[model samples]
Target chain A: MTDNNSGFSDTKQEIMQATYDAIQQHGYAGLTIQSIADNFGKSKAALHYHYDTKEDILAAFLNYLLSEFRETIQIDEDSSPEQQLLDLVDVLLYGPDNSSSEEIFQMQTALLEIQSQSPHKQLYRDQFTQIYHWLGNLFVEIINNGIAENVFRDVNAHLTAQHLLLIIVGGILNRHTTNSEMSPDQIREIVTAQFLPYLKK
Target chain B: MTDNNSGFSDTKQEIMQATYDAIQQHGYAGLTIQSIADNFGKSKAALHYHYDTKEDILAAFLNYLLSEFRETIQIDEDSSPEQQLLDLVDVLLYGPDNSSSEEIFQMQTALLEIQSQSPHKQLYRDQFTQIYHWLGNLFVEIINNGIAENVFRDVNAHLTAQHLLLIIVGGILNRHTTNSEMSPDQIREIVTAQFLPYLKK
Candidate 1:
């Protein structure tokens, strides 16, 4: 019975992977359950067995993404708070190092499309809220840790975190939405240089 | 002949107003040409007579919005650069003083939805690109003026402007996407306190 349950879990994981691939290829606007099934290498009937509608599968996909993001962004307690903060920003801005630029761009576009729908979709809004809260808490914790260690100046940790969150979120949106001329590396350098000085003692 | 031309311009402007009202009421997701026609107080045939399709109407609406934005955000040449900058940020964040909170929120939700569709729609993308460029240039000009007037530090005007733009755009997105506890006035105060000090010499 344990083995059967494990197999079932693996199939669900496969479905999530297929959904990601489908969104990347077709974009959220073009995405359909059939497209996800096509990516899954399964029949539409099989997909319908697990999810009744595209929104149902997409909602599950958001949960899957949040868990994956939580797993991936494991902050190192051993590292200095400053380094941890920079690393977190890097992850948010540049995404995974393994993914090609084209892949990252396509994924960002798909995510923005989903984000645009969040206002109308409660499932997406709930997941995004949770994600934002998780990120904000991480930032606050790091800032507080830095202050405690006497490595950073005294600052309103909550306010500072909100400021940083604004930049990070804005940077991600601007990348796809605006006709930005600066490369990602340029933006990272600018953000680091311009903002970090204010935090130092 | 001039009267006939003026009448033509008036009808187009009226159509744009109807589109705006429709989007605010139904949101971009639920918006249809018929809905716009309903707001227009005209038959669908009249709307079709003016524009062939929904996308065409929306494209024209985007242009109308851009022109209206340009007219609305007029920076006073006589004001201090610092005040000009703050006023611009206020306009972007809080919108016009006349609009109610609910109306502003609904308009933002609709705009974000349209922005999300930008990647797939060239017409929308072009308009957004133009809008961003216009906003960025305005920031750069104000920053440069501040530096020249000895009111601000000798910061890289281009980079500094980009940073400010990131915050502004991000703040707007966060208001709708995240479950932020901060009120608009609170955020305005926080942003002004945290970021402005860095610019002063």
Candidate 2:
């Protein structure tokens, strides 16, 4: 039973990796089931057995990304609430240390493309909704913790969270959409200097 | 010469209006030169005579939108800087009174889709960059005026403008992408309560 479960997980990872590679090479608009299969190093029929359409595979890829994001931003109990919040912002903007800035930008552009389709595609909308909720909840948790610890000012956690979420979302969109000149470090500095003071005790 | 110029501007307005209608009906992804022509109530050949490809017409459409945006968010000399800034935010989120929320959302979704393509389309990228600059400059002007008039705290106008831009951009993306439950009023309240305090004296 353990072996079967491990194998199933392995296959899922492979599919996700293939999807990532295909997207990196062909972009979201240019990607196809066959292209993903090419990256998978397997027959298109094998990929077809798993996902009937490109959207199905892409939906699965979104799930994979969500799980990956969940793992990447796992809250460290040892860190201060403030640190955790900042780290969350860092990951959202610059991505994990393993990925280069260009790679992060590429993936973000592709995600934005998929997001644009969300209004028309229920599957994409559902995944994006989950992502939004998860991020908002994380911010709320950190801010609430900070308040409890007496490290942050007494503020409306939900409202603050919403504000942070908006800034982050806007930063990402502006960065890629307009080819913004603001570096990630510059953004961090802006947040710290302009925004964090209001929250900090 | 004046009559000729008027006729030329009238034709451009017609083309822009038709492009807007086509995008509204078919969306960015589904949009085609033929669809735009169908909405124009003109022959495809007429459109082709002016613009060789869909991209060309869309690029012109973007320019038209930018001009319309500039006109819609015109700064009133009589209003206080604070009022101007707030009004700008209102226009960004809810759009002009002439358009319904559903219409605005549909247009935003289509714009997001085109923005997602900006990375690949230089014309789109240029237009978006110009739009970003125009918006940012408007914010800077308002903030600077507020500071000079003693209505706002002494702050870095550029940084404040950037933050506001980020929030505005983020709010729009979140409102559409997540189908956020936060109504325009709720968003306005949050912005008023959480963000505006930092700016006012």
Candidate 3:
């Protein structure tokens, strides 16, 4: 592996983007190196040369999404805790638009599918575990800050955080499984309008 | 197909039990007719006679679980809405013992795998949709009653119910993905002790 500027990393990003699109469209079971190759107009052998196996590609895909999640997570320090919370919900529930949200829903659904598998379960466990804790800690910080500022009532910061995560997580699962109609606005409305009231004075 | 008695139904139960054991052990991807056949002393041919294809068996397995879930859901009308909520949390998180909760975890894991597939999506959608509505409606009623009785904070019952579902759903996803130690008791405690306080008076 020769080190180079953006050339190798650029190919990697292209591979992952193709993967994300394929998985969203066809799912993990339906996905193959050939399918990913189809997106790039490359042969399956070319895909195999870049990545040895589907597992290798998937591992990279998971890493790609994790990096994206970390990069996009931004919270303004000076904002009210309530505003911060809404920001968190916005990041979790939607992206720039419906199209991005759809991609996210597909990404999450794909991850859950992989997470449930025994072989990948151990492999991906640590990364997701870090994510779980990071979010939990963020919620705890928000709650504690809110209490300190006296804008919200004193609630059990840890439990409240877990509760919020639960709803967000549950909402994510529901997006794929439920037959109900859910647009991006509906999800945001539920988060800010319905779920947020519990924390508000 | 001739109408039969308990004998046929009992055979159906046994087959589904085998399917459950196989899925819990091997996961949906690793699931095979042989794996299920291994559960009973029955051969693959015998299994095929009962189920034409692996899809048939999985479909049956899903239906069996759905019926079991409906049968077990019971509530005392006389109990306070708070008690009802706790009871709901308890049932969702765990059962009388760890084994049952473990089984529930496996069942959910299997369903999630099938759910990610394009073919099985429609078959499972109606059943899951009914379940989503049933649980949401249950939450709405409970919240409405709690506010009426002055036992809970005046929260938007519909949203609150959805939030509660979120925690439970998130917890389910966490059960498989997180490496954290969470027994049935710990999960129940988190729900009752940490998350429950916000709604109670």
Candidate 1 off by > 4 Å: A1-8, B1-8
Residue B93, candidate 3: Cα error in Å is: 1.2
Give, for candidate 1 chain A, the lowest lDDT window spanning 10 residues.
Answer: A1-10
TM-scores of all predicted structures:
0.91, 0.93, 0.81
- Cα lDDT tens digits for candidate 3, B1-201: 122322338778888888888998987778999999999669999898788988778767766765665556666689988888888777777742345655677766677666545224676666567667888887888888989999988887876777677667767777767786445565566567655676788
lDDT, candidate 3, at A25: 85
Using TM-score as the measure, which candidate wins?
2
lDDT (Cα, tens digit) per residue for candidate 2, span A5-32: 2223777688888999998888888898
The most accurate candidate by lDDT is 2
Of the candidates numbered 2 and 3, which has the greater DockQ value?
2
Model 3: chain B TM-score vs. truth?
A: 0.74
Docking class of 3: medium
Inter-residue clash pairs, candidate 2? none
Which of candidates 2 and 3 is the stronger one according to TM-score? 2
Which candidate leads the pack in DockQ? 2
TM-score quality measure for candidate 1: 0.91
lDDT of 2 by residue, B1-201 (tens): 112222237776788789999998988879998898998899999989888988888888788887887656788889999899999989988889778988887898888878878878988888888899989999999999999999999999988898888887777777777756656776786678877888899
